[model samples]
Target: MARATGIRGIWHSLPLERYTSRDNYIWLVVATVCIGAFMAAVDASIVNVALPDLSTYFHASASLVSWVLIAYLLTLATLLTLFGRLADMMGRRPLYTFGFLVFIIGSAACGAAINLPMLIVSRVFQAAGAAMLQANSVAIITATVPASVRGRAIGFQGSAQAIGLSLGPAIGGGLIGLFGWRAIFYVNVPVGLIGTLMAAAILPKDKLSGHKTTFDWWGTALMTPFLVLLMMALTEGNSWGWTSPTILGMFAASGLLLVGFIFRELSFRAPLVDMRLFKIWVFSVGNFTGLLSYLAMFGVLFLMPFFFERVLTFNSAVTGLILTAVPLGMTVAAPKAGAMADRYGPRLLTTSGMALTGLASLLLAWTLSLHPSVVMMVIELVLVGVGLGVFTPPNNSSVMGSLPSSRLGVGGGILNMARSLGMAMGTALSGTIMAVVLIAHGGVEKAGGPKGPWIPSTRYSLYVLVALSLLAALLSLFRVAEKDSSKHESMPLEW
Candidate 1:
């Protein structure tokens, strides 16, 4: 007990903050937050690359093994809002610090899993930890950083996430090849520990409101099941048959729950989500366009792997390398775009970014028919990345900037929830479109197996993405122009 007390004292007494000036200190906080962002993003994609090895090792069917990914997604999606609100009510520092500890423990558990069920369960635990981290990251940035450089700080965090996501496949494949599938999970342990310490040491102390507020337990109950049901239905609709009773029931139930949740929030004293935040033009439109932006981005990501492997006949390594071009472009563009948004308003940058992405997607569709060279393909993908990178930071800055400091947590949660929904929708939509296209063309077997159907299916899917991007660009124009950062800082939320 004495040793424990002594260690705790030492932990609390670390004078890390004294080393940096105020301006530099905020960037340090941003850097610390990026660790969580990077780790969570990495795990999301890393497990995917090792799915085949996991199936073989466990002697599980592909359908059964997919739950490893599905379980993580469902769990992460369900808890983000809850934890985000908790950060508001409780405090971000403790929640974020604890999140790191939980993530580390979950990573270790995942690495040590001996059976398929065990692995799936461990993934759920890991995702919960990830939810905690993600829920608080943007809120922390919003509260700590100066408004002048907010976009740039958010851009760095986004860049970290993009880089982590981009590297996941390469890292997972290399780790699996060198030390088997477990290595991918094991890799998080050391990094997570460093993040934990950094978070504890560097993060600003949370400022708690003096008045006690009730947690919207009823709101959470309704919202949680609504999201789970909605996500399950969206993800499984194709496999379960779109019109099947099971899928229909899930969708119906989810819709009713959503309505109930909306009603509950409107009536509650302290709602889970402040319903009035939507009244702000920037908040509502930003989220809508944010969803569309990710929908287009992930749609392309989902379709490209199939196109690369089947149509282009590329190996997994080469496909992974080529795919990195998208995120590589994002990494390069996000910081600069963010800094630009900080100077000029988000309207022009966001609108131009999505327009660029729409043009790039159209070009990709055209290139698909031309049997384009590898260099041309990579260049096109990079252009798409640059567009998204440019769009995301500024858009996220606008959405987050529009919120009051008191509501930043829930706002950030809603922002991330939109992103998750967009990704799920993108994957489902792209796959469904491809399947339908192939079906119309007499199916894959009838259309000369893998090669023939893939090109047309992928081309059509890219066309849909182009439309989505253009629509997002149109929506970007609707946002009320911000003459200065002070406008967002004092933006009124109609109650």
Candidate 2:
């Protein structure tokens, strides 16, 4: 009886009555969620800029220091589904608020790290918190906002992410230059604290699926090993050699684990992920295309800095400034694309966006030179960004729309997992291709100047990325079907 009373009191604290007008309340929720979205996005990208400085400080090999990045990404990717399931079983409000606290603590720990291992450990904690935040970001938005403007709300969230991403290089570079690499991690503490407070005060209480469901421990057990092994294989493939015994063994092990996970999910009474969700063609196709879109985007992001600094002889600062075009384009296009997706179906916009991105990549592959013009590079990146901007919100909305409210947490978790997987794959694949091609061009290691095998190898990698982008476009155009826009409309009782 006391437990029931405590639940009631916490529910009452939601303040829905205070914001009796639904429209005002909806925007407030968006405002609150955007804070977390922006901060998480910023942190993910900011660390890249600080990596070299960190390597110098720790006096570590590039491969070892890379664990700083790999550890965070690997932990975040593997745990996203688990946390999403927990959010449904528990409550998003408390979990989200707790995530902020955990993230703040992790950030402080990262900042205070005495060595690389300590920093890597802190990053693991940071990624766990990030998984909690990301797994529910879409689910919470889907629950609160009216379906009529759901796309727009999601668009604004995407814009917030773009804003965060755009600022990361600038903020990260400045912080590192001014204070040190530690300052980059320290910046999150204050921002995370504010977000935590706002989440506690402003976010509405989540209604636990109006029914009790057992947590899928068996499925989670299978999934954890599957994802970790797969991500490790992908991340280490460049250094380990694709055909090396260790890399091959990891891949084979991941495949077996994946098979086990699929079997468990299908057989389990309370599966962490409902295998049937993939049978919804829209959900499945949207997710696949979404993964491909991110793969293409991050492929360019990973490769371009090399192109800028090594080939074009630009400094890191200039390269950082130039990269802003991508996110800026995303910020500009996302909201408009969201609004458009609401009117026309997502099929046209998504297909067109992926097609455009492929064309942009092809253009870069064909036209890029040893001394590529800054204007041309910016235009290409902006086009890629715009394509992603147009594709993501609608794609995400469609995935979330296909699921019942009860399954939104798991569905969103799956969607985010695709994204994280895509990012890792893109970076790994492009990096691998470049490394192989450069190695084949024997003079690359000796040539500090741009004239060696690196330039052609970079171009060839872009060619491969173009193919991947076009393949994604084909999938979007052919596989994804037109769904009822009304499917996204707000249901009063669900909220």
Candidate 3:
């Protein structure tokens, strides 16, 4: 099939293909990738509800309970850059296939966990699999599809993830209510098996790069300890005291390792991540802006459910239903925003989206005094949902389009890695802040009783999120070209 063409005559942002006997199987690939992406995204949301269940199951302290989440996030964070490098070394197909298998194993272990430590360990394994899948899916799709249709393909793929994430609470709550917490883990088994089989059949086999690259063993070595230490410090610092030897040591070591990793990447021949990608104005600004934006967006998601159930006095099911607006709005708006970015440019859509996102954050902050009304909450959340729907696709397009085709594999990997880090940092940071604030306010008793301190803590967190969103808007403004500038001006990706 002759590929579709757009005005600039360079083809659309990505490739396209006509369905053929040989190509009928492409849908299988789409299904496979989408399923994996959806699973990873949904798990993030699903587990939020399961934490209490897990806490009870293990009879652990709040600090230990929190590690159930922190451990998974830290592991995923530590592995993403490494996994991206590994995919560059090994074929994406094999790595992608193996990811699903690993995920299945992790899920089973989680379902059958005998103790809290075991569950956290299982989650670590699951996170490893998730990183592998996330870093490779976009690269795989870009490789298989013609660029003419790439935006649509990626848009739909992202949409699946959005829907899955939106529905996660509903699914997890429903499964947990009916069957038990174990159902959440068991749910992934069939999907993992199917996705594994399809990926093996559709994705072409290829060998790891034979070029004698060393994989930046030093970069990988330092990064893990850096993230683990940082997250551990953040999670435990309040309990241990910021000045406590343990917290101070972790903080100090994390700083040293991070600085060491940065110097190592800049000096390495083939760095684990191409540090030079930071030099591209769009790539740099877009990623930082997006990261901060995710910090706010997911911070809200992580904290809101607690507010809904405890302060506002709603049930878990209702919280899930109300939160549904975010994903729903994203599902509605992403493709349209993507299409507009395709026609107009990423500048308007992304900046405007983020600006609106800031507005939503402000709305929540403004309304903190009032009791949570489902209607008001839904409306504010809808704005957030719409803003995210608008912001993500265009920003993603700009970042991904800025790269050359050859680098798509690694570039896509790095992009997702940044997102994962932001997500982990967001939830962990907010959780830690919420805990500290509540304790400081009146030793957790003033916040609330058995209900929760969600109102006070969430309100404070929203203020922080609002500031972050505004910063994101400013970053987007700086990065995106003015309407009069030539956005498509040829620039080498060799920076």
Instruction: Return the top candidate by lDDT.
Output: 1
For residues 448-492, what per-residue lDDT tens digits would candidate 1 score against the true structure?
Answer: 254766778888989999999999999998887534435455544
Residue-pair clash count for candidate 3: 8
Per-residue lDDT over 1-495 for candidate 3, one digit per residue giving the tens place of the 0 to 100 score: 234434334322112232223655556567778988999888877876665556556765344566766777667766876776677677677788889999999999989988888888999999889888887787778777778888778767877788788898888777877788889999999989988866766665454557643567887898888988998898778778989999999999999999999999888876767787776678788888778767777777777766665566555566667777777777788879988988878877888887887788778766754364567778888898788889888888788777655556556667776777777777777777777776766534222354434466677877788788887877777665434213334433332
Q: How accurate is candidate 2 locally (lDDT)?
A: 0.75
In candidate 2, which residue ranges exceed 4 Å CA deviation?
1-29, 51-67, 114-117, 138-156, 201-211, 342-344, 367-369, 401-409, 443-451, 480-495
For model 2, how does the per-residue alpha-carbon lDDT over 61-151 read when each residue is reduced to its tens digit? 3334556766676677677877876887888888888888888999999999999999999998998888788777877888988999997
CA shift of 177, model 1, Å: 5.0
Task: Name the TM-score of candidate 2.
Answer: 0.83
Clash statistics: count for each candidate: 0, 1, 8
Per-prediction TM-score? 0.81, 0.83, 0.86
**Clash-forming residue pairs, model 1:** none
On the 0 to 100 scale, the lDDT of residue 386 in model 3 is 89
lDDT of 2 at 160: 84
Identify the runs in model 3 with alpha carbons over 4 angstroms from their true place.
1-23, 55-64, 146-151, 207-213, 342-344, 368-370, 404-406, 443-452, 482-495
Which stretches in model 1 have alpha-carbon errors above 4 Å? 1-31, 47-74, 109-121, 138-159, 176-182, 200-210, 310-313, 339-344, 369-372, 401-409, 435-449, 482-495
Candidate No. with top TM-score: 3
